[model samples]
Target: MTTASPAPELSLRDKPGFSDLQGVTVEHGLNTQDMVVNIGPQHPSTHGVLRLVTTINGEIVKDMEPVIGYLHRSKEKMAEGRSYFQYQPTIDRVEYLSSFYDHYVYVTAIEALADLKVPKRVEYIRMICMELNRITSHLLWFGTFLLDLGATSPFFYAFREREAIFKLFEDITGARMMYNYFRFGGVNADAPPGWLDDVRKVINELPFRFDEYEAIANKNPIVMDRCIGVGVTSYQDLLDYGVTGPSMRACGVAQDMRKTNPYSCYNEVEFDVPTATEGDVYARYKVRMAEMRESIRIVHQLLDNMPGGDSAELRKLEKEHAKVAEEIAAAKKRVTVAKKNEEAPNAADVAKMAEKAPELPFDYRTTGQKVNLMVFKPPAGEAFSMVESPRGMLGCYLVSDGTPKAYRVKWRGASFSNLTILPSMMIGNLYPDLMAIFGSLDIILPEVDR
Candidate 1:
C-alpha cells in the first residue's frame, strides 16, 4: 500500500444531491502514491455537516477518518444546574429528529429517580404517541436517505405521510417537533377529542402507502446498485461498538430496548422485532421499513382499545393532594407555635378555622394522586438508562449527589458508536459508495455531537 503525506488545505464544495463517479480516477501506478480528499463538513451527501478525510488509491478507498463536533451543543453540561423537569426540554434538542423518544428516556429516568408511578391510561397513551413518533422519525430517515441517493420523488412522497403524523402530534402536544409533552409521572395532558380517530386513520392508511413506497424505491435497480453490500458493518463490530436499534438489528441482532427492557407498555404490545443477516446499507433500509410496519400495528392496537378518562381530572387530583399536604404542614406549624407559647389563641378558634376551610372540590378529586412534586433526588445511586431512539440505543447515565440536580450525566449516543464503523466500511469501496455507506449508517449529527 502506498502512503501519501496529508494535504495542507482542501477546498470542499456542496452538491445538492448524490452523484456517481462513472469514470473519475485518482492517479495510481507502481511509482504513484495515494491522494487525500476531504468529502464533507458542508457536502449535502454526508447527511449533516460530517467531514470525512479519505485516503484513496486510484478509484478505491484506502482509509478514511470521520471528523465530527461541527454541531456540538453542551447538553450534558447544560443539564447540570437545571432541575430535572426543566432539563427535559433540553433533551428534546439532543436528538431533534426524534424528540419524543428523547423526552421519554429523560422523563423515565427522572420518574425512576423519584419513584413515581404512572397511571395505566397514561402509560398506554405514551406508548401510542411514542410509537407514532417512531414511525414519523423513520419516515424522515427513509425520505432523507433516498434524497442522499439522488431520488427526489420519494422524499416528497414520504414527507406527505410524515406531515399527517406530525399533525397528530401537534393536535395532542401543540408542537410538531420539540414536544416537551411527557411529564414526570405522566404526559403534559391527555389527547384531545377525535385524536384517536386521527391516529386510527393514519395507521389504517399507512400500509398501503408503504406498499407504494416499496414499489417505487425498493426494487429500483439504481437504489439496489448503490445500497446493496455497501457500508457493511459486521455483527461483532456492532456489538463491540455498542450499536443498537435498526442499525444493530440489520446486523442480525434482535435486541430492541422496547423488547428487551420493556419500558412503558411495550411489554404488553405485540410486534415482531425485525432483523437482517447482512449488516449493509440495504439491510438497514429493509429493517427500518419493517419497523415502520410494526409501529403501525402497535398504533392500531392502541387506537382500538383507546381508554376513556379525562386527563384534566387526573391533573386536578394531583393538585388537590398537593393542597392537602400544604394545609397539613401549615396546621402543624400553628400547633407547634401554640405549644411553644404558654398562652396562645383559643384552641376552639383554631379548630373552627380548620373545620371551616372549604372542602376539596369534587372536580379536584379527578386529578391523579399528588405524589411529591419535588426536584429529582436519586438515592446517592447510579442508574444507566437506555432507549431505542430512531437512530439507535440512546443512553443516559445519571449519578445523583442526593440533590435535585444530577451530579454527573453521561450520554451514550448510538450515532457516536455507529459513526466509528464508517472508516472500516469505507475502505476498498469506490468514491460514490461512500454516500451509500454513510446514508445506510442512518446517524443524526446532533445526537452524535451531544
Candidate 2:
C-alpha cells in the first residue's frame, strides 16, 4: 500500500524542454544517468561560434537545441542606412566562404528594381567567378569535414587547391577573400591581362586532382564506417524540414537553384546535379564531392563558351571605336544648334531604336553609362532573387523607396534554415556521432547568426 515508500524524484533543476526521467534508460537492470551538456559557443566542431545544448542518456542523444546569434553583425539594418554602392564592401563578410553569391543576389535585386541590362560578357564573367567560388567553398568544406572525421591529409590537399584558386581571384578581384567585385550591371573590372589564360590553366588541371581526392576517401574503411548508415533523412523529411543544397541532394531530390531558378548566367551552362538515395552522412559527403567535380565541369564550359573574340577582331573593333570617337570630337568643335522644348518621345519608338542598336563585340564589356554608387537608387519597388550558393538557396529581398537608402533589406542565408534540422537528426543517435552528423550538414555560422 505504501508502494515501497515511493522513490524520490531525481531531476536537474530547471532544464529546458526535457525532464530527467524522460530521456533516462535502464541497461542490465541498472538505472542510468541523464546529463545535460553544452557542446559549444566556441568549440571547433561547432564551426563558428555555435552552441548546441544537448541532452543525453548514456551514449544516446535525447534532444538538442542550437543556440545561435553570437556573430550577428546587423547586416540587414546596416543596409537600410548605406547606399547600394556603399554597401558592396560589407557584403563580403556576410558569408565569407562564398561572398560572390551574396553580391550577385543583392546586385541583381537592385538591377531588377531598376530594370538594368547586364552585358553578356559580364554575365559570363560572373558565372565563371561564381562557379570557381563554389569549388573553393566546397574545397574548404571538404578539408574541414575530413579533419572533423580525424583525417588530416584531405585538409592540406584541399587547401592546396584553394590557394591556387585564391591566386586567380586575387589577380582579378584585387582581394583574395573579400572580392567586392560585382557591380550592379557589371563587375569591378574586366578580367586582367592574360587572366583568362590563368583560369583555363587552373581549370584544366583540376579534374585530375579531384580524381585523386576521390581515390583517397571514397572507399576507406574508417570513412565509410563513420558516415554510412548514419543521419538518415528521407527526401520527404528534408522537404518538411526546408533543407536544400547537398543535404537535399543527398536525400536524392536533385534540387539545385542553378537549374530550377537559373539566376545570373546559369541558364546558359550545362552541368549535372548529383544525388544519393541513402540520405545519411556518407550520402551528404558523396553529394558534395560530386558537386566539386560538377563545378569544375561548369567552369570549363564557361571558359570555352565565353563571349570574347579573336585578337585580330578585337583590334579592328578598337580601331573603329577610336575613329568614331575622333569624329564625335570634330563634331563637338562646330557650333551645333541646340533644340528647344525637349518633348517626351514615344515609348514604342524608343523600344524600336533600342532593338536596332548593334551589340558591341564580346571583348567590349558593357561598362559605365556610369551610375555612381554614392547617389545611385532604384525606383520605388521590391525585388527578390536567389542563387545556388554552396550551402543552398541564398536569396536577397530588397525594398527601395526611390532613395539612396533601402527602405528594407532581408537576407535569406541557407545556413539559417539548414541549421534547424540538427536537433531532429541528432535525437536518438549516439552522442559521439555528433561531430559526424553536424559536419555533414556543413553549416557556416556567420550566415546562420547574421
Candidate 3:
C-alpha cells in the first residue's frame, strides 16, 4: 500500500469505436482485431484540420468517418452579430483559397436584397478576379495533390506559376489572399492605370507553363497508376450528396455555375465546361486541369471586350463635365461664405455639391456611387446567392430583418457535402489510396466547417 504498486500498469484498452487487437482469434490460431487509426486534425495532406476515424482490418479499410468542425470559425453566427461592412473581412476566413467566390456570393446576396445596380465595368472586373482566383486555386490544388501522391517537383512547379498571379492580386487588392475588394453595388476601388495590361501579360504566359506541367505530369507512370480508375463516383452519387464543381463535372454532367446559372457577366463571355465520363481520381484531375485553361480563355475574352464608352460617348460626357464645372464654382463660393460666418454647411450647401457633381460614365466609375457604410441597412428581405467556387457550388443565404445587422447567414460549402461520400467510398479500398481519393475532391477543411 505504501509503495503504490507501479500505478497498476495503466493501459487504455477496449473502448467503443476501438478494441484491443489481442482479443480476437483467427482460423490458424493467430489473434487479430480491427485496428482504429486517427488520421488527423493536423495531417499535411488534409489541407486543414480534418480528422479521419478509420477502422482497418489487415491492409484494407473497413470503415472510415470524417470528424469535422476542428477548423470551424462560426462564420454564419459571426454574420448575425456584425454589420454588413464589418463582416466582409471575415468571409475570407471561410474559404481562403478562392475567397473572391465567397465575396461574390455574399455581396451579391446583399445586392439582391437592396436591389442595387452594378455597372458593367464592375461586373467585368469581378469576373476577371474570380476567374484568375480559380486558376490560382486549381494550380495550388494541382501542386499539392501530386505532392500528396508522393511526387515532390510539381509542388514547386505549380507554386512558381501561382506566385506570378498573386503579384497581380497584391497590386490590385493590397492583401494577397484575404481581399476585401467587393462592395455591395461594385468593387471597393478601380483598377489602376495599366493594370489591364499586366493581366493580359500574365494570362498570356500561363498556357505555356500549363503545357510544361502537362508534359511532366500528365502521363507520368506513377501519377497515372495512382489516379486512374481509383475512387470512382457516379453522377447520381454526386446528386445524392449535393456535390458540384470539378468532381461533378468529372462524372460527365456539365453543372458549372458559370455556364448553368450565369452570374457576374459570365453570360457575356463564352467558355466550354470541360468534362470527363470516368468519374474517378484521374477524371477529376483532368477536369480541374481543363477548367484552368477555360478560365484563362474567359479572362482573355473579358479583357478583350472590357466595358467602356465609345469616343462619341466620351465626348458627350466631357460636355456634361464642362457644364458641371461652372455650377461647382458657384457652389464652392456659397460654402466659403458659410464657413467664414462660422456656420455649418446647411442642406442647401450639401445639395449644391450633389447638384454640381458630374455623372461619370459607368465604365470610368470603377466603384459604386457613395453610400454611407457606417450605418447601412438593406430592405427587409431574404436572398440566396451562389457562385461556382473551385471546390464546388458555394452559396450564401442571407435574411435581412430591416436592421443594420443580418438576422441570419448560412454558408453552403462544397467540402461538407463532398466529404460525406468519403467513408462510403473508402470502406473497401486499400488504406494507402485514401490520399489519392480525398485529395481529388480538393476539399479544404475551413470551407467545410465554416
Candidate 4:
C-alpha cells in the first residue's frame, strides 16, 4: 500500500527558538505566553547590584521592573546623626565616581545657610576638579559600556587614562577615590607644588588617547549594529520621565543645568553642551564622547587662567604674612604695657605705634574666613543647592535647627530619576539588547539606592 499520509505540518511555534508554555497560542500559532527572567542582583552587565525582573516572550522583552535598594547605605539618615563636618567624609561614597560634585553640593548648601563666602580662587579650583572628574567618570562609562557589548581592549585603555588622573588626585587630595578635599568655604588644602603642571601634562595627552579608543571601538560593526537603532525614546518621553544628562541630551533636548542655570565658575568658562537627536544608544555614546572633549577644554582654560597665583607666589605671600603678623603682635603688646603703667614712655606714642602697625597679610581668599568647623552650626533655616554633575543635576537640600547637625538632608541624584525610564525603554527590545540600552543610561547603583 501507499506510504502513511504525511504528518500534519508543525506550527512555526514548534521551531527551535520557540518554547511551548501550556497550550497558549497567538493567531499565527506562535506562543503567546510570557517567561520571566531575573537579570541581576548578581549579574555583571548590570554595572552594580541591580535586579531586573524582566518578562519576555521568546526573545522579546515584554516588561521590566527594576528592583533597587540593594546598595542603600542609609546615607541620608547618617547626615542627621553626625555634625556637618563629620558627615563631609561620608559624602564621597554617595557617587564615588564623581564625589567632588557630591561635596560641592553638600558644602555649598551649608554655605548658603551659613552665609559663607567661597573665594574666587577656591571656586576656580573646584571647577577644575569637577571638570577633570567628569572626564574620569565618562572614561569609566566608555570602557564599561563597550565591554558590556563584548569589546575588551577599551576597558584597559580607559583605566590607563583613569590612573593618570588618579595619580594627580593623589598628589593633591592625598586619596584617589575618597577625596574629601572640599570644605565649607574653601578647599581643605591648596594644590600641591607642580600639581597643576602635572594635571596640564596629563590633560593635554588625553585627547590623543581618546582618538585611539574611537579608532578601536567606535566604528566596529557590532557596536554600530547593536547601538544605532536600539533603545530609542522620544524627546518628550525623556522630559516626561525626568531623565537628564547625556541620556536626555541624546533625545535632541539641550537641558543641561550647566547651561540653563550656571553654578560655580561654569558661567566664566566656555564649552558647548553636546547633544544628539537620534535618542538611541549610539546617540548617547556620541554625546558623552563629545562631553569628554568639552571637559578637557574647560580644564585647560581654568588651568591657564587659574585665579590663584602660581605656587611660588603663594609661598612668598606666606612668608610676608609671617613677618607682618610678628610686627602687629609686638605693637599690640607695647600698647597693653603702656596702658597698664602710666610711667611707660609716651603712652600716646605707644597708642600711635599700635594704630600705625601693619595689618597681617592674611589671604582670606586662600584660607577662607577661618571658622571653627568642629562646632560650626548654621542658622535655623533650609537651603538647597544644585550642580551639573556628570550624571545630571546633583542637588542637596538641608534643614537646619540652628544646630551642629542637619535637621533633615535630602539628595536628588540623577541616576535615581534616570533609572525610572529603563522599563519603558526596554520593553519590546530584544533580550540581547538589554545591556546596550541599560549601559547607555549609565545608572550607578549607589545614587539609586542612597
TM-score of each: 0.80, 0.87, 0.86, 0.90
Judged by whole-model lDDT over C-alpha atoms, candidate 1 comes out at 0.78
Q: Put down candidate 3 lDDT per residue, 1-450, tens digits, no spaces.
A: 687666554334422333444534242333456789999988998999999999987668889989999887888899999899999999999989999999999999999999888888888888989999999999999999999999999999999989888888988888889999999888887676567888999999999999999898889999999999999988888889888889999999899888888988888888999999999999999999999999999999988887752334545676888787776765666665755646645657667677758767666556565666779899999999998999999999999999999999999988888899899889989899999999999998888999
Where is the poorest 10-residue window by lDDT in model 2?
330-339
Error of 3 at 7 (Å): 54
**Which candidate leads in lDDT?**
4
Winner on lDDT between 3 and 4 is 4
- Candidate 3 regions with alpha-carbon error over 4 angstroms: 1-32, 309-358
Sum up the clashes in candidate 3: 0
Residue 434 miss distance in model 3 (angstroms):
0.3
Question: Between 1 and 4, whose lDDT is larger?
Answer: 4
Global lDDT of each candidate: 0.78, 0.85, 0.87, 0.87
Clashes of each: 6, 0, 0, 0
The candidates, ranked best first by lDDT, are 4, 3, 2, 1
Tens-digit lDDT track of model 1 for 1-450: 378868655322122222235323323212234788998899888767789999886678988998999988899898887876677778888887888877777767766776767766777788888888888888988998899888999899989999999999899999999899888777777787567777888788999999999999889999998888787888887778766778889989898988888887777778999999888889999999999999989878766654544345445655786686677556656665855645655656667766665554432221234544455465677767778877888878877778878877878888898888888778888877887788877888888888
Candidate 1 TM-score over all chains jointly: 0.80
Residue 61 displacement in candidate 4 (angstroms): 0.2
What's the lDDT for candidate 4? 0.87
Model 2 / residue 14 / CA error / Å: 28
